[model samples]
Target: MSPNPAPRPSASDTPPRRRSVQCAGPHGLHRMSYLEWGDADNPDVLVCVHGLTRNGRDFDELARAMAPHYRVVCPDVVGRGLSSWLPVKTDYQLPTYVADMITLIARLDVDSVHWVGTSMGGLIGMLIASIPDNPIRRLVLNDVGPVVTAASLARIGQYVGMAPVFPHFEAAEAYIRAVSAPFGHLSDAQWRQLTESSVKAVDGGWAMRYDPGIGEPFRQTPLLEDVSLWPIYDAIGCPTLLVRGAESDLLTRETADEMGRRGPRARLVEVPGVGHAPTLMDAGQIAPVRDFLLAAGAAGGGR
Candidate 1:
Protein backbone atom coordinates (compact mmCIF):
# COMPACT_ATOMS: atom_id res chain seq x y z
CA MET A 1 0.00 0.00 0.00
CA SER A 2 1.16 3.58 -0.67
CA PRO A 3 2.09 5.69 2.38
CA ASN A 4 -0.64 8.03 3.54
CA PRO A 5 -0.36 11.59 2.30
CA ALA A 6 0.36 14.43 4.71
CA PRO A 7 -2.71 16.25 6.01
CA ARG A 8 -3.32 19.59 4.40
CA PRO A 9 -3.81 22.62 6.65
CA SER A 10 -7.20 24.23 6.65
CA ALA A 11 -7.88 27.85 5.58
CA SER A 12 -8.21 28.88 9.21
CA ASP A 13 -4.62 27.80 9.73
CA THR A 14 -3.29 30.32 7.25
CA PRO A 15 -1.39 33.47 8.24
CA PRO A 16 -3.07 36.88 8.47
CA ARG A 17 -2.78 39.92 6.13
CA ARG A 18 -0.99 43.00 7.51
CA ARG A 19 -1.25 46.76 6.90
CA SER A 20 -0.69 50.18 8.50
CA VAL A 21 -2.90 53.28 8.68
CA GLN A 22 -2.05 56.78 9.83
CA CYS A 23 -4.31 58.21 12.53
CA ALA A 24 -4.29 61.76 13.86
CA GLY A 25 -2.85 62.04 17.35
CA PRO A 26 -2.33 64.89 19.84
CA HIS A 27 1.06 65.73 18.39
CA GLY A 28 0.68 65.89 14.60
CA LEU A 29 -0.41 62.85 12.56
CA HIS A 30 1.19 59.52 13.58
CA ARG A 31 1.07 56.17 11.91
CA MET A 32 -1.10 53.77 13.89
CA SER A 33 0.06 50.48 12.38
CA TYR A 34 -2.49 47.69 12.20
CA LEU A 35 -2.63 44.09 11.02
CA GLU A 36 -5.54 43.77 8.60
CA TRP A 37 -6.77 40.36 7.50
CA GLY A 38 -9.61 39.26 5.23
CA ASP A 39 -11.28 41.29 2.45
CA ALA A 40 -10.81 45.03 2.81
CA ASP A 41 -14.34 45.61 1.60
CA ASN A 42 -15.94 43.17 4.03
CA PRO A 43 -18.57 45.03 6.05
CA ASP A 44 -18.03 42.72 9.00
CA VAL A 45 -15.25 44.47 10.86
CA LEU A 46 -13.78 43.03 14.04
CA VAL A 47 -11.37 45.27 15.96
CA CYS A 48 -9.02 43.51 18.37
CA VAL A 49 -7.27 45.59 21.02
CA HIS A 50 -4.36 44.42 23.17
CA GLY A 51 -3.34 44.94 26.79
CA LEU A 52 -1.34 47.71 28.51
CA THR A 53 2.14 46.56 27.63
CA ARG A 54 1.23 44.49 24.55
CA ASN A 55 0.91 45.59 20.92
CA GLY A 56 -1.51 44.89 18.05
CA ARG A 57 0.51 41.79 17.04
CA ASP A 58 -1.09 39.90 19.93
CA PHE A 59 -4.10 39.18 17.72
CA ASP A 60 -2.22 37.76 14.70
CA GLU A 61 -3.28 34.16 15.20
CA LEU A 62 -6.80 35.13 16.20
CA ALA A 63 -7.13 37.45 13.20
CA ARG A 64 -5.87 34.74 10.84
CA ALA A 65 -8.45 32.32 12.16
CA MET A 66 -11.32 34.79 11.80
CA ALA A 67 -10.35 36.26 8.40
CA PRO A 68 -12.64 34.04 6.33
CA HIS A 69 -15.70 36.19 7.09
CA TYR A 70 -14.54 39.20 9.05
CA ARG A 71 -12.16 42.05 8.38
CA VAL A 72 -9.96 41.74 11.45
CA VAL A 73 -8.20 44.99 12.36
CA CYS A 74 -5.68 44.79 15.18
CA PRO A 75 -4.28 48.19 16.06
CA ASP A 76 -1.22 48.98 18.14
CA VAL A 77 -2.88 51.44 20.50
CA VAL A 78 -0.91 54.68 20.64
CA GLY A 79 2.30 54.48 22.73
CA ARG A 80 2.58 50.76 22.06
CA GLY A 81 3.93 48.56 19.25
CA LEU A 82 5.05 50.29 16.04
CA SER A 83 2.81 53.29 16.82
CA SER A 84 4.49 56.47 17.94
CA TRP A 85 4.76 56.98 21.68
CA LEU A 86 3.24 60.10 23.18
CA PRO A 87 5.62 62.94 24.06
CA VAL A 88 3.45 63.60 27.07
CA LYS A 89 3.01 60.36 29.01
CA THR A 90 0.09 61.97 30.85
CA ASP A 91 -1.84 61.84 27.58
CA TYR A 92 -1.61 58.04 27.66
CA GLN A 93 -5.10 57.73 29.07
CA LEU A 94 -8.36 56.21 27.83
CA PRO A 95 -9.75 59.45 26.40
CA THR A 96 -6.79 59.64 24.04
CA TYR A 97 -7.14 55.98 23.09
CA VAL A 98 -10.85 56.45 22.45
CA ALA A 99 -10.13 59.49 20.26
CA ASP A 100 -7.53 57.59 18.27
CA MET A 101 -10.02 54.76 17.82
CA ILE A 102 -12.62 57.24 16.59
CA THR A 103 -10.14 58.46 13.99
CA LEU A 104 -9.46 54.88 13.00
CA ILE A 105 -13.16 54.16 12.60
CA ALA A 106 -13.60 57.25 10.44
CA ARG A 107 -10.64 56.19 8.30
CA LEU A 108 -12.24 52.77 7.81
CA ASP A 109 -15.37 54.67 6.78
CA VAL A 110 -17.50 52.06 8.51
CA ASP A 111 -20.80 52.61 10.28
CA SER A 112 -19.89 50.42 13.25
CA VAL A 113 -17.57 47.63 14.39
CA HIS A 114 -17.31 44.62 16.66
CA TRP A 115 -14.72 45.08 19.40
CA VAL A 116 -12.55 42.55 21.25
CA GLY A 117 -10.28 43.86 23.95
CA THR A 118 -7.90 42.49 26.59
CA SER A 119 -7.30 44.10 29.99
CA MET A 120 -6.65 47.80 29.41
CA GLY A 121 -8.03 47.51 25.92
CA GLY A 122 -11.23 46.08 27.36
CA LEU A 123 -11.59 49.16 29.53
CA ILE A 124 -11.32 51.38 26.46
CA GLY A 125 -14.00 49.39 24.66
CA MET A 126 -16.26 49.51 27.67
CA LEU A 127 -15.90 53.26 27.92
CA ILE A 128 -16.31 53.99 24.22
CA ALA A 129 -19.05 51.49 23.45
CA SER A 130 -21.13 52.88 26.28
CA ILE A 131 -21.47 56.28 24.67
CA PRO A 132 -24.87 57.35 23.30
CA ASP A 133 -23.67 57.32 19.68
CA ASN A 134 -20.99 54.68 20.04
CA PRO A 135 -19.88 52.77 16.98
CA ILE A 136 -19.25 49.43 18.64
CA ARG A 137 -22.06 47.04 17.85
CA ARG A 138 -20.79 44.12 19.91
CA LEU A 139 -18.16 43.94 22.60
CA VAL A 140 -15.81 41.35 24.11
CA LEU A 141 -14.03 42.08 27.36
CA ASN A 142 -11.07 39.76 28.03
CA ASP A 143 -9.85 39.47 31.63
CA VAL A 144 -11.09 42.82 32.87
CA GLY A 145 -14.21 44.25 34.54
CA PRO A 146 -15.81 47.40 35.89
CA VAL A 147 -14.18 46.94 39.24
CA VAL A 148 -10.40 46.48 39.10
CA THR A 149 -8.75 44.58 41.93
CA ALA A 150 -6.14 46.34 44.05
CA ALA A 151 -3.95 43.28 44.10
CA SER A 152 -3.84 43.07 40.32
CA LEU A 153 -3.34 46.82 40.00
CA ALA A 154 -0.44 46.68 42.43
CA ARG A 155 1.13 43.79 40.57
CA ILE A 156 0.90 45.64 37.26
CA GLY A 157 2.16 48.86 38.78
CA GLN A 158 5.23 47.06 40.12
CA TYR A 159 6.52 46.37 36.63
CA VAL A 160 4.71 48.92 34.44
CA GLY A 161 6.78 51.78 35.85
CA MET A 162 10.09 49.99 35.78
CA ALA A 163 12.45 50.47 32.82
CA PRO A 164 14.52 47.39 32.15
CA VAL A 165 17.50 47.08 29.87
CA PHE A 166 18.38 43.62 28.56
CA PRO A 167 21.67 42.60 27.05
CA HIS A 168 19.98 40.52 24.34
CA PHE A 169 16.67 39.30 22.92
CA GLU A 170 17.00 36.02 24.81
CA ALA A 171 17.26 37.83 28.10
CA ALA A 172 14.36 40.10 27.22
CA GLU A 173 12.22 37.14 26.15
CA ALA A 174 13.11 35.28 29.32
CA TYR A 175 12.12 38.23 31.44
CA ILE A 176 8.79 38.55 29.59
CA ARG A 177 8.09 34.84 29.99
CA ALA A 178 8.74 35.00 33.70
CA VAL A 179 6.44 37.95 34.26
CA SER A 180 3.81 36.67 31.85
CA ALA A 181 3.49 33.20 33.37
CA PRO A 182 -0.04 34.18 34.36
CA PHE A 183 -0.95 34.09 30.63
CA GLY A 184 -0.18 30.34 30.72
CA HIS A 185 1.05 27.63 28.34
CA LEU A 186 2.11 29.54 25.22
CA SER A 187 4.16 27.57 22.67
CA ASP A 188 7.83 28.33 21.95
CA ALA A 189 6.82 30.01 18.70
CA GLN A 190 4.13 32.06 20.39
CA TRP A 191 6.59 33.16 23.06
CA ARG A 192 9.06 34.16 20.37
CA GLN A 193 6.42 36.22 18.60
CA LEU A 194 5.52 37.97 21.82
CA THR A 195 9.16 38.75 22.45
CA GLU A 196 9.75 40.06 18.96
CA SER A 197 6.69 42.33 19.01
CA SER A 198 7.37 43.59 22.51
CA VAL A 199 11.07 44.43 22.38
CA LYS A 200 13.26 46.58 20.14
CA ALA A 201 17.01 46.58 19.68
CA VAL A 202 18.55 49.73 21.14
CA ASP A 203 22.28 50.38 20.68
CA GLY A 204 23.76 47.13 22.11
CA GLY A 205 20.68 45.95 24.04
CA TRP A 206 16.96 45.27 23.82
CA ALA A 207 14.14 47.23 25.47
CA MET A 208 10.35 47.23 25.59
CA ARG A 209 8.41 48.89 22.76
CA TYR A 210 6.55 51.37 25.01
CA ASP A 211 7.87 54.50 26.69
CA PRO A 212 8.80 53.73 30.27
CA GLY A 213 7.37 57.12 31.28
CA ILE A 214 3.95 55.92 30.17
CA GLY A 215 3.62 54.24 33.53
CA GLU A 216 4.24 57.45 35.43
CA PRO A 217 0.56 58.33 35.52
CA PHE A 218 -0.28 54.99 37.07
CA ARG A 219 2.33 55.52 39.74
CA GLN A 220 1.17 59.05 40.42
CA THR A 221 -2.46 57.99 40.71
CA PRO A 222 -4.00 57.31 44.09
CA LEU A 223 -4.51 53.73 45.28
CA LEU A 224 -7.94 52.48 46.14
CA GLU A 225 -9.34 49.19 47.36
CA ASP A 226 -11.89 49.06 44.59
CA VAL A 227 -12.26 51.30 41.54
CA SER A 228 -15.77 50.98 40.21
CA LEU A 229 -17.06 51.94 36.76
CA TRP A 230 -20.37 50.12 36.74
CA PRO A 231 -22.10 53.17 35.29
CA ILE A 232 -19.95 53.05 32.17
CA TYR A 233 -20.64 49.36 31.64
CA ASP A 234 -24.33 49.83 32.25
CA ALA A 235 -24.42 52.43 29.50
CA ILE A 236 -23.33 49.86 26.93
CA GLY A 237 -26.19 48.80 24.65
CA CYS A 238 -24.38 46.27 22.47
CA PRO A 239 -24.21 42.50 22.90
CA THR A 240 -21.14 41.75 24.99
CA LEU A 241 -18.92 38.76 25.76
CA LEU A 242 -16.58 38.43 28.72
CA VAL A 243 -13.70 35.94 28.90
CA ARG A 244 -11.78 35.33 32.08
CA GLY A 245 -8.78 33.16 32.68
CA ALA A 246 -9.83 30.74 35.45
CA GLU A 247 -6.85 31.60 37.62
CA SER A 248 -6.64 35.27 36.75
CA ASP A 249 -5.51 37.61 39.50
CA LEU A 250 -7.01 40.53 37.62
CA LEU A 251 -10.62 39.59 36.81
CA THR A 252 -11.76 37.80 39.90
CA ARG A 253 -14.42 35.09 39.71
CA GLU A 254 -16.75 37.34 41.64
CA THR A 255 -16.28 40.18 39.17
CA ALA A 256 -16.91 37.93 36.18
CA ASP A 257 -20.09 36.62 37.78
CA GLU A 258 -21.25 40.15 38.51
CA MET A 259 -20.42 41.16 34.96
CA GLY A 260 -22.82 38.52 33.69
CA ARG A 261 -25.55 39.28 36.20
CA ARG A 262 -25.42 43.02 35.62
CA GLY A 263 -24.25 45.60 33.08
CA PRO A 264 -24.98 44.36 29.52
CA ARG A 265 -25.35 40.90 30.95
CA ALA A 266 -22.24 39.85 29.03
CA ARG A 267 -21.87 36.23 28.00
CA LEU A 268 -18.99 34.75 29.95
CA VAL A 269 -16.31 32.13 29.14
CA GLU A 270 -13.45 30.87 31.24
CA VAL A 271 -10.23 29.42 29.90
CA PRO A 272 -8.47 26.77 31.95
CA GLY A 273 -4.76 26.86 32.87
CA VAL A 274 -4.56 30.59 32.23
CA GLY A 275 -4.64 33.81 34.19
CA HIS A 276 -5.10 37.61 33.74
CA ALA A 277 -6.03 37.14 30.00
CA PRO A 278 -6.51 34.79 27.07
CA THR A 279 -4.36 35.52 23.98
CA LEU A 280 -6.97 34.01 21.59
CA MET A 281 -4.19 32.19 19.72
CA ASP A 282 -5.28 28.62 20.53
CA ALA A 283 -8.21 26.98 18.70
CA GLY A 284 -10.02 26.40 21.95
CA GLN A 285 -9.56 30.03 22.96
CA ILE A 286 -10.30 31.54 19.55
CA ALA A 287 -13.50 29.56 18.92
CA PRO A 288 -15.65 31.51 21.40
CA VAL A 289 -14.48 34.81 19.94
CA ARG A 290 -15.20 33.69 16.36
CA ASP A 291 -18.63 32.47 17.36
CA PHE A 292 -19.39 35.67 19.24
CA LEU A 293 -18.30 37.91 16.37
CA LEU A 294 -20.35 35.96 13.81
CA ALA A 295 -23.45 36.20 15.96
CA ALA A 296 -22.84 39.88 16.57
CA GLY A 297 -22.32 40.59 12.89
CA ALA A 298 -25.49 38.77 11.97
CA ALA A 299 -27.46 40.77 14.49
CA GLY A 300 -25.81 44.13 13.71
CA GLY A 301 -26.30 43.95 9.94
CA GLY A 302 -22.64 43.16 9.34
CA ARG A 303 -21.39 46.19 11.26
Candidate 2:
Protein backbone atom coordinates (compact mmCIF):
# COMPACT_ATOMS: atom_id res chain seq x y z
CA MET A 1 0.00 0.00 0.00
CA SER A 2 1.08 3.54 -0.73
CA PRO A 3 1.81 5.94 2.12
CA ASN A 4 -0.79 8.45 3.26
CA PRO A 5 -0.22 12.00 1.98
CA ALA A 6 1.14 14.34 4.65
CA PRO A 7 -0.59 17.69 5.19
CA ARG A 8 1.54 20.79 4.93
CA PRO A 9 1.66 23.11 7.92
CA SER A 10 -0.67 26.07 7.47
CA ALA A 11 0.66 29.62 6.97
CA SER A 12 -0.70 30.83 10.32
CA ASP A 13 1.03 28.15 12.33
CA THR A 14 3.91 29.53 14.42
CA PRO A 15 7.47 28.27 14.20
CA PRO A 16 8.90 25.82 16.71
CA ARG A 17 9.89 27.08 20.15
CA ARG A 18 13.34 26.29 21.49
CA ARG A 19 13.18 25.06 25.09
CA SER A 20 15.30 23.22 27.66
CA VAL A 21 14.78 21.19 30.83
CA GLN A 22 17.30 20.31 33.54
CA CYS A 23 17.67 16.54 33.80
CA ALA A 24 19.39 14.71 36.67
CA GLY A 25 22.33 12.56 35.65
CA PRO A 26 25.08 10.44 37.19
CA HIS A 27 26.71 13.65 38.37
CA GLY A 28 24.43 16.54 39.30
CA LEU A 29 22.27 17.69 36.34
CA HIS A 30 22.51 18.78 32.72
CA ARG A 31 20.16 20.67 30.39
CA MET A 32 18.48 18.80 27.55
CA SER A 33 17.30 21.08 24.75
CA TYR A 34 14.30 20.47 22.54
CA LEU A 35 12.21 22.16 19.80
CA GLU A 36 8.47 22.41 20.26
CA TRP A 37 6.09 22.91 17.34
CA GLY A 38 2.31 23.26 16.82
CA ASP A 39 -0.23 24.19 19.52
CA ALA A 40 1.22 24.21 23.01
CA ASP A 41 -2.21 23.31 24.31
CA ASN A 42 -2.59 20.29 22.08
CA PRO A 43 -2.53 17.10 24.16
CA ASP A 44 -1.69 14.82 21.27
CA VAL A 45 2.12 14.80 21.17
CA LEU A 46 4.60 13.18 18.81
CA VAL A 47 8.24 12.91 19.90
CA CYS A 48 10.76 12.43 17.09
CA VAL A 49 14.30 11.40 18.05
CA HIS A 50 17.31 11.33 15.73
CA GLY A 51 20.12 8.82 15.10
CA LEU A 52 23.37 8.31 17.06
CA THR A 53 25.39 11.32 15.96
CA ARG A 54 22.62 13.52 14.50
CA ASN A 55 20.56 16.12 16.35
CA GLY A 56 16.87 16.99 16.60
CA ARG A 57 17.02 19.45 13.69
CA ASP A 58 17.28 16.44 11.42
CA PHE A 59 13.51 16.13 11.79
CA ASP A 60 12.64 19.65 10.65
CA GLU A 61 10.94 18.53 7.45
CA LEU A 62 9.06 15.72 9.17
CA ALA A 63 8.01 17.90 12.09
CA ARG A 64 6.66 20.64 9.81
CA ALA A 65 4.55 18.11 7.92
CA MET A 66 3.09 16.57 11.10
CA ALA A 67 2.75 19.81 13.11
CA PRO A 68 -0.61 20.50 11.45
CA HIS A 69 -2.15 17.44 13.08
CA TYR A 70 -0.12 16.92 16.26
CA ARG A 71 2.11 18.81 18.65
CA VAL A 72 5.55 17.77 17.38
CA VAL A 73 8.56 17.67 19.67
CA CYS A 74 12.16 17.08 18.60
CA PRO A 75 14.81 16.73 21.33
CA ASP A 76 18.58 17.07 21.10
CA VAL A 77 19.44 13.99 23.12
CA VAL A 78 21.96 14.99 25.80
CA GLY A 79 25.52 15.26 24.46
CA ARG A 80 24.25 16.21 21.00
CA GLY A 81 22.90 19.43 19.47
CA LEU A 82 22.23 22.27 21.97
CA SER A 83 22.01 19.92 24.94
CA SER A 84 24.81 20.06 27.50
CA TRP A 85 27.54 17.43 27.55
CA LEU A 86 27.96 14.93 30.36
CA PRO A 87 30.50 15.62 33.08
CA VAL A 88 31.80 12.06 32.53
CA LYS A 89 32.12 10.94 28.92
CA THR A 90 31.14 7.33 29.68
CA ASP A 91 27.79 8.63 31.02
CA TYR A 92 26.60 8.71 27.39
CA GLN A 93 25.10 5.27 27.84
CA LEU A 94 21.40 4.40 27.40
CA PRO A 95 20.65 4.56 31.14
CA THR A 96 21.47 8.26 31.23
CA TYR A 97 19.67 8.93 27.97
CA VAL A 98 16.53 7.11 29.15
CA ALA A 99 16.48 8.94 32.48
CA ASP A 100 16.82 12.27 30.72
CA MET A 101 13.87 11.44 28.49
CA ILE A 102 11.74 10.59 31.51
CA THR A 103 12.36 14.08 32.84
CA LEU A 104 11.46 15.59 29.48
CA ILE A 105 8.21 13.67 29.39
CA ALA A 106 7.28 14.72 32.90
CA ARG A 107 7.82 18.34 31.87
CA LEU A 108 5.47 17.84 28.92
CA ASP A 109 2.66 17.09 31.44
CA VAL A 110 1.11 14.39 29.27
CA ASP A 111 -0.20 10.95 30.14
CA SER A 112 0.86 9.36 26.85
CA VAL A 113 2.91 10.05 23.72
CA HIS A 114 3.61 8.65 20.24
CA TRP A 115 7.26 8.01 19.42
CA VAL A 116 9.37 8.01 16.22
CA GLY A 117 12.96 6.97 16.96
CA THR A 118 15.79 6.50 14.47
CA SER A 119 18.75 4.14 15.00
CA MET A 120 20.08 4.74 18.51
CA GLY A 121 16.88 6.57 19.34
CA GLY A 122 14.93 3.45 18.32
CA LEU A 123 16.89 1.38 20.80
CA ILE A 124 16.01 3.85 23.52
CA GLY A 125 12.34 3.71 22.58
CA MET A 126 12.42 -0.10 22.57
CA LEU A 127 13.67 -0.20 26.15
CA ILE A 128 11.07 2.31 27.29
CA ALA A 129 8.18 0.65 25.45
CA SER A 130 9.19 -2.69 26.88
CA ILE A 131 8.44 -1.49 30.38
CA PRO A 132 5.04 -2.48 31.72
CA ASP A 133 2.50 0.34 31.20
CA ASN A 134 4.85 2.56 29.24
CA PRO A 135 3.44 5.92 28.20
CA ILE A 136 4.30 5.30 24.54
CA ARG A 137 0.98 4.52 22.87
CA ARG A 138 2.55 3.76 19.52
CA LEU A 139 6.18 3.30 18.49
CA VAL A 140 8.07 3.68 15.21
CA LEU A 141 11.57 2.25 14.96
CA ASN A 142 13.40 3.74 11.96
CA ASP A 143 16.13 1.48 10.56
CA VAL A 144 17.22 -0.17 13.83
CA GLY A 145 16.26 -3.17 15.92
CA PRO A 146 17.10 -5.38 18.93
CA VAL A 147 20.13 -6.94 17.28
CA VAL A 148 22.96 -4.51 16.42
CA THR A 149 25.81 -6.05 14.41
CA ALA A 150 29.37 -5.64 15.59
CA ALA A 151 30.46 -4.84 12.02
CA SER A 152 28.04 -1.91 11.81
CA LEU A 153 29.11 -0.77 15.29
CA ALA A 154 32.73 -0.84 14.18
CA ARG A 155 31.91 1.15 11.02
CA ILE A 156 30.22 3.91 13.07
CA GLY A 157 33.08 3.99 15.61
CA GLN A 158 35.52 4.95 12.85
CA TYR A 159 34.14 8.51 12.83
CA VAL A 160 31.57 9.06 15.59
CA GLY A 161 33.75 11.60 17.34
CA MET A 162 36.65 12.05 14.93
CA ALA A 163 35.36 14.94 12.78
CA PRO A 164 37.94 17.54 11.82
CA VAL A 165 37.58 21.31 11.87
CA PHE A 166 37.06 22.85 8.43
CA PRO A 167 38.49 26.18 7.31
CA HIS A 168 35.32 26.89 5.32
CA PHE A 169 31.64 25.93 5.41
CA GLU A 170 31.92 24.10 2.07
CA ALA A 171 34.49 21.78 3.60
CA ALA A 172 32.12 20.99 6.46
CA GLU A 173 29.26 20.27 4.07
CA ALA A 174 31.45 17.96 2.03
CA TYR A 175 32.49 16.06 5.14
CA ILE A 176 28.87 15.62 6.22
CA ARG A 177 27.88 14.40 2.75
CA ALA A 178 30.71 11.86 2.60
CA VAL A 179 30.07 10.41 6.08
CA SER A 180 26.28 10.49 5.74
CA ALA A 181 26.10 9.02 2.22
CA PRO A 182 24.02 6.17 3.62
CA PHE A 183 21.18 8.60 4.29
CA GLY A 184 20.61 8.16 0.56
CA HIS A 185 19.85 10.98 -1.89
CA LEU A 186 18.80 14.26 -0.31
CA SER A 187 18.27 17.63 -1.97
CA ASP A 188 21.09 20.20 -2.03
CA ALA A 189 19.09 22.35 0.38
CA GLN A 190 18.66 19.39 2.70
CA TRP A 191 22.40 18.77 2.72
CA ARG A 192 23.04 22.44 3.54
CA GLN A 193 20.48 22.31 6.34
CA LEU A 194 22.21 19.28 7.85
CA THR A 195 25.59 20.95 7.61
CA GLU A 196 24.33 24.20 9.12
CA SER A 197 22.86 22.48 12.15
CA SER A 198 25.81 20.13 12.65
CA VAL A 199 28.66 22.60 13.01
CA LYS A 200 29.57 25.72 14.96
CA ALA A 201 32.21 28.40 14.36
CA VAL A 202 35.48 27.79 16.17
CA ASP A 203 38.65 29.88 16.73
CA GLY A 204 40.38 28.30 13.71
CA GLY A 205 37.31 27.30 11.66
CA TRP A 206 34.08 25.33 12.05
CA ALA A 207 33.79 22.25 14.28
CA MET A 208 31.17 19.64 15.11
CA ARG A 209 28.56 20.85 17.59
CA TYR A 210 28.65 17.71 19.78
CA ASP A 211 31.33 16.93 22.33
CA PRO A 212 34.09 14.70 20.97
CA GLY A 213 34.28 12.94 24.32
CA ILE A 214 30.89 11.34 23.60
CA GLY A 215 32.77 8.66 21.70
CA GLU A 216 34.73 7.48 24.73
CA PRO A 217 32.27 4.76 25.70
CA PHE A 218 32.21 3.29 22.21
CA ARG A 219 35.99 3.12 22.11
CA GLN A 220 36.18 1.57 25.54
CA THR A 221 33.73 -1.29 24.86
CA PRO A 222 34.57 -3.26 21.74
CA LEU A 223 31.77 -5.49 20.53
CA LEU A 224 32.94 -8.99 19.68
CA GLU A 225 29.59 -10.03 18.18
CA ASP A 226 26.05 -8.79 17.54
CA VAL A 227 24.26 -7.33 20.58
CA SER A 228 20.79 -8.78 20.92
CA LEU A 229 17.77 -7.42 22.85
CA TRP A 230 15.12 -9.95 21.91
CA PRO A 231 13.79 -9.99 25.48
CA ILE A 232 13.13 -6.23 25.35
CA TYR A 233 11.57 -6.44 21.88
CA ASP A 234 9.21 -9.16 23.01
CA ALA A 235 8.18 -7.26 26.15
CA ILE A 236 6.62 -4.35 24.28
CA GLY A 237 2.83 -4.54 23.88
CA CYS A 238 1.91 -1.27 22.17
CA PRO A 239 1.12 -0.82 18.48
CA THR A 240 4.36 -0.56 16.53
CA LEU A 241 5.75 0.18 13.06
CA LEU A 242 9.27 -0.51 11.83
CA VAL A 243 10.89 1.32 8.89
CA ARG A 244 14.04 -0.18 7.42
CA GLY A 245 16.45 0.96 4.75
CA ALA A 246 16.53 -1.83 2.13
CA GLU A 247 20.31 -1.74 1.92
CA SER A 248 20.88 -1.16 5.63
CA ASP A 249 23.86 -2.87 7.19
CA LEU A 250 22.55 -2.34 10.71
CA LEU A 251 19.04 -3.75 11.01
CA THR A 252 19.06 -6.82 8.74
CA ARG A 253 15.92 -8.17 6.98
CA GLU A 254 16.03 -11.32 9.13
CA THR A 255 15.85 -9.38 12.40
CA ALA A 256 13.10 -7.11 11.07
CA ASP A 257 11.01 -10.17 10.19
CA GLU A 258 11.27 -11.48 13.74
CA MET A 259 10.17 -8.07 15.04
CA GLY A 260 7.02 -8.34 12.90
CA ARG A 261 6.17 -11.80 14.23
CA ARG A 262 6.60 -11.02 17.92
CA GLY A 263 5.69 -8.41 20.57
CA PRO A 264 3.47 -5.71 19.04
CA ARG A 265 3.96 -7.34 15.67
CA ALA A 266 5.10 -4.07 14.07
CA ARG A 267 4.09 -3.35 10.50
CA LEU A 268 7.28 -3.06 8.45
CA VAL A 269 8.20 -0.77 5.53
CA GLU A 270 11.51 -0.66 3.70
CA VAL A 271 12.91 2.31 1.78
CA PRO A 272 15.02 1.10 -1.17
CA GLY A 273 18.54 2.49 -1.72
CA VAL A 274 18.96 3.80 1.80
CA GLY A 275 21.27 2.28 4.42
CA HIS A 276 21.85 2.39 8.20
CA ALA A 277 18.94 4.84 8.66
CA PRO A 278 16.41 6.82 6.65
CA THR A 279 16.35 10.54 7.36
CA LEU A 280 12.63 11.33 7.60
CA MET A 281 13.08 14.60 5.70
CA ASP A 282 10.84 13.80 2.73
CA ALA A 283 7.17 12.96 2.10
CA GLY A 284 7.76 9.29 1.31
CA GLN A 285 9.45 8.78 4.68
CA ILE A 286 7.18 11.03 6.72
CA ALA A 287 3.89 9.55 5.49
CA PRO A 288 4.33 6.09 7.04
CA VAL A 289 5.18 7.59 10.41
CA ARG A 290 2.23 9.97 10.23
CA ASP A 291 -0.23 7.25 9.24
CA PHE A 292 0.87 4.88 12.01
CA LEU A 293 0.67 7.56 14.69
CA LEU A 294 -2.63 9.01 13.49
CA ALA A 295 -4.44 5.81 12.58
CA ALA A 296 -7.74 4.99 14.34
CA GLY A 297 -7.39 3.34 17.81
CA ALA A 298 -3.91 4.80 18.11
CA ALA A 299 -3.32 6.54 21.42
CA GLY A 300 -4.07 10.25 21.32
CA GLY A 301 -5.69 9.80 17.92
CA GLY A 302 -8.38 12.24 16.67
CA ARG A 303 -7.57 14.64 19.47
TM-score of each: 0.90, 0.95
Native-vs-model 1 lDDT? Answer: 0.82
Best by lDDT: 2
Score each candidate by Cα lDDT: 0.82, 0.87
Residues 1-303 of candidate 1: C-alpha lDDT, one tens digit per residue? 001111222434555665666766666666677877776666667889999999988998887877776677899988888887778788788888888888888878888787899999999999988888888877889999898888888888889848588998999999889888899999999999989989999987999998787788889895778778899988887888899999999888998898888768988999999998888888999899878777523445212
In candidate 1, list every pair of residues with a backbone clash.
none
Off by over 4 Å in 1: 1-29, 301-303
Q: Could you tell me the lDDT of residue 246 within candidate 1?
A: 100
Lowest lDDT 10-residue stretch of candidate 2 = 1-10
Tens-digit per-residue lDDT, 150-188, candidate 2: 989999999999999999999999999999999999999
* Alpha-carbon runs more than 4 Å astray in model 2: 1-12, 300-303
Residue clash pairs of candidate 2: none
